[model samples]
Target: MTEKIAIQTKNISKRYVIGTKNSKPNTLAGEIINFISTPIRNFKKLRSLSNNTTDNTKTIWALQDIDLTINEKEIVGIIGSNGSGKSTLLKILSKITIPTTGEALINGKVGSLLEVGTGFHDELTGRENIFLNGTILGMNKKEVEENLDKIISFSGVSNFIDTPVKRYSNGMRVRLAFAVAAYLEPEILIIDEVLAVGDSSFQKQCLGKMDDVAKSGRTVLFVSHNMESIMTLCTRVIWIDEGKIIKDGDPVSVVNEYLETTNTISETNINLENINKRGGDGSIKFTNLTIMDKNQKEKTQFNIGDTLNLSISLKAIEKGLLNSNLTIKILIKNQNNTTVLSFNNESYNHFIKLDDKNNKIQFSIPKLPLGQGLYSISLEVWVNGGKADTVGDVGVFESTPGDFIGNGIPDQEHSLFHTNSVWS
Candidate 1:
C-alpha cells in the first residue's frame, strides 16, 4: 500500500536577526494600518533572507535544510535541547511564524497548541473561544456546537466555560485549548511542550487523546522533554541539534541514543554543589556524588551482577537541620527516563542521625540487576516531613553483560533489568 503524506518540508530554514526593532503604532488607525501591512513586511523580509548575506553575526538560523515528510497516521516525536528549533518548526507548520527560506507544505487542516493561551481571545469566554478556534479551522458553528460539551467536560473546565479566557489560570487555559484542538477533528495535530503547564493527570489525558487521534487516521507532531511519553505515544522519533536533523528512526533506538548522548554524565564522580537544584527548599543541599565498584574504585561502567556503590555528601544550610528527621532517597531510571529502581531510608524504617561535620551517606546494590544500558540516578532529601533538597540525573552508570545465570545468555532484549528464573 502507498503512503499518503500529511506534511512535507523542503529545505525549510528560519533565520532571526538579533536586536531588530519594530515600532509600535500610537493611534487606533495606525494600529489598523500596521496590522494590515504586517504580512507584506514579513513577506519582504522573508524574501530578503535569501539575497542578503552582508552581516552573518546579526542573524541566527533556527532551522537549516529541514527536509521531512510525515505520512498520515504517523505520530512523530521531536526531541532536542532548548534552542534546537523544535518549537520553530512547529510554529512554521502552525503558520504562527514564517520561515526565512524555503517552505513547509502541509495537507488538510492543522490544530496546534504551541503555547498557553494561543489562538484564544482574552475577552472571549472559553465557550466562545472554542467556536472561534473551530471557525479558524474552517468548522461551522453547528459542528463546533456538537462537540462543545465534550470539549468542556474533557477539559474539566465546565465550571469556568462561561468565564473569559483572561480570567483563567495557565492550567485552565491549557486544558481548554487542548480540548478545542483535539476535539475539533483536524487532519493534523501539532502539540508543543505547552502540555507541561498542565498537571500530570491532565498530561496523561492529553496523551491518551493524541493516541485516539492517531488511531483515527490522523497525523500527530509532538515536541516534549518527557522521554517516556514520547516513547509510549510516538511510533517514530526525530532528534534535532544545532538546527539540523541528527537522528530519526525507531522510537526506542532514537530515544535511547538521545538520552545517552545528551543526559549521561561521563564522569564517575560529579560535584553536586554546582549542579542546579530541581526542587525543594534550600534548607539542605547535596554536595557531591561518586559512583564506584565493589573495590571502591571509582567507575562509570559495571558488569551485570557486579556490586554498585554510591556515596552522596550533603550539608545543612539552616540551623538545627542536622538534628531534624531527615530522609534520603536515591532513584534510578533507564535510558527511556522511566524509573527502574528506587531506594529510600524511610521505606526500610532505617533512621539515620546526621553529624555536623560528617554528613555523607552510602548506598550499595549487592547485585546490579540491570542489563547492558545506561542508567541515571536522582537524589532527594526530606527534613521533618518537608522536602529539603532534590535533584535529578545527578549521575549515570552503564551496566554491561555479565554472568547472572549459570548459562550466561544476554537478557536485556525484552526487559530493562535482568532476573534469575528457574524452569521446572
Candidate 2:
C-alpha cells in the first residue's frame, strides 16, 4: 500500500521582474532619457545582476524552492507576511499561474475563490457567473445545475441573481463567489482572504461550509490573517516567510510562531494588506496605527502614570458619513491575551464626531492603570449599525514602572490589572 497525497510540490519557484530607478535620474530630461533607454538599461542591468553576484537581483522569487506534501482530507492553513508568497503558492496549485522553475502536482479537482470577482465576468449575470465559475472549476452544465439552487440560496443573492454582476458590490460578489466555490463540491478547496469582503454573518457561514467540506474528506488550503480562525479550523499549518516554507506542522505552534514574528511595536505606517485577520464593510480602512506618549514621542514602553495615546489613521471609502454614524472601540489586553480594559465610543452618543474627512483618530488614556507587562491592543470600528473595520493584535506596548504616587515603584502582576486598594 502507498500513502496518498492531496497536493505536492517539487522545488517549486516563481519569479517576477520589477524596475528600480537609476540614482542619476532626478530631472525630467533624465526621466525621459531613462524611459527611452528602458529596454537597453534592463538588459544591461540583467547582465550586471548575472555577473557572479550571487544576489539574484534581476528577479524576485515570490516562491523559492518550496517542497511539501499535503495528505488527503487534511485541512492545511497557510500563514505568512505580506508578499511572503502565500498567494503565489495557491495560484500555482490552482493552475491560475505556472511556476517559473518547479512543478506542482494536484491530485484532485480544485475549486478556488481567490479574489472577490474571480472567475466572474462583469457582463454576466449573477446566475450565469455562478455556472461560469463552476465550469472553470471543471464542473459541467448538469453538475452546476444540480447545485444551482443551493448556491443561490447560500449566497442570498436571489433578488439579484438575474442582474449583471457588474453592478454588484464587493460584498455581493464575495457572497456569490464563495457560494460557487463551496457548494459545487470540488475535491480540493483553495480560499484566500476574499471572505473578508462580506459581512460577519456570511463569513461565519463560509467558515461553516468549509468545515463541512473538510469533514467530507475533501482537502482544504486556508489562508487567513485571523489567528483565532486558523487555530479553530486547521488541522495542520505551514508558515511561509520570504518565499520559503519555514515551519510546517501543528496549527497552534505554527500560528504562535507567525504572531511572534510580526512587529509588536511599529513606528511607521502599517501595511493593511499584510493583515489577513482584518475585515470590514468597505466603508473605512485603517492605514496606520501608532502608539505614543503625551509628549508626541514614539515608543512602545509606557509608564503606568503616562498618558498613552493611540493614533489610528484611516481613509474614508465614500462620502456622506456623518461623525455620529460611526463608532470606534479600542481595547487592551495583558501578555496572556486577556481583555483587561475596553473603551467604546458609542457611535450615537460619543461627543467627538468623525470628521467624515478626518483621516486620523486618537484614543487617549489619561494616567494609564496597568501593571508591568506586555500588552496588546485591538481595534474595531462600526458605521451605520454595521462593522466597518476590525484589526486584532494591532499593536503591543510595554507597561513599565510608574510613580503616580510619591514612590517610584511599578504595579506588577501577571493577571488582569494592578490596582491600589486601601483597607476599609
- Highest TM-score model number: 2
> Whole-model lDDT for model 1 versus the true structure?
0.82
lDDT (10s digit) by residue, model 1, range 1-424: 9999999999999887543335567789999999999999888667655555557754778899999999998999999866688999999999988888898889988887776455689999999998887777657899889988898899899999999989999888888877877776778888888656588899889878877877888788999888888888898999998689999999999988987686665688888888642457657889889999999999999888889999888887754577778899999987656688999998889887777787888889988998788888988899899887888877888888776664666444645677777789
Please, what is the whole-model Cα lDDT of each candidate in the order they appear?
0.82, 0.77
Q: Which ranges in model 2 have alpha carbons more than 4 Å from their true place?
A: 24-55, 263-292, 296-298, 302-424
Tens-place lDDT per residue, model 2, 1-424, is 6768989999998886543334456689988997999899778778764343334543577899999999888999998765689999998998888888889888988887687555689999999998888888777999999999999999998999999999998788888887887766778888886655578899899878867887898889988767787888899999998799999999999888767666365543455545644556546667678888898777788877788887887666554454546678888875444478898877337654566567678878878778777777888888777877888767888887775543566544444354555778
For candidate 2, what is the lDDT?
0.77
Candidate 1 error regions (>4 Å): 20-53, 136-138, 166-169, 266-424
Per-structure clash totals for the candidates: 0, 3
Measured by TM-score, how close is model 2 to the native structure?
A: 0.64
| TM-score for all models, in order of appearance | 0.57, 0.64
List the RMSD of every prediction in angstroms: 12.9, 10.8
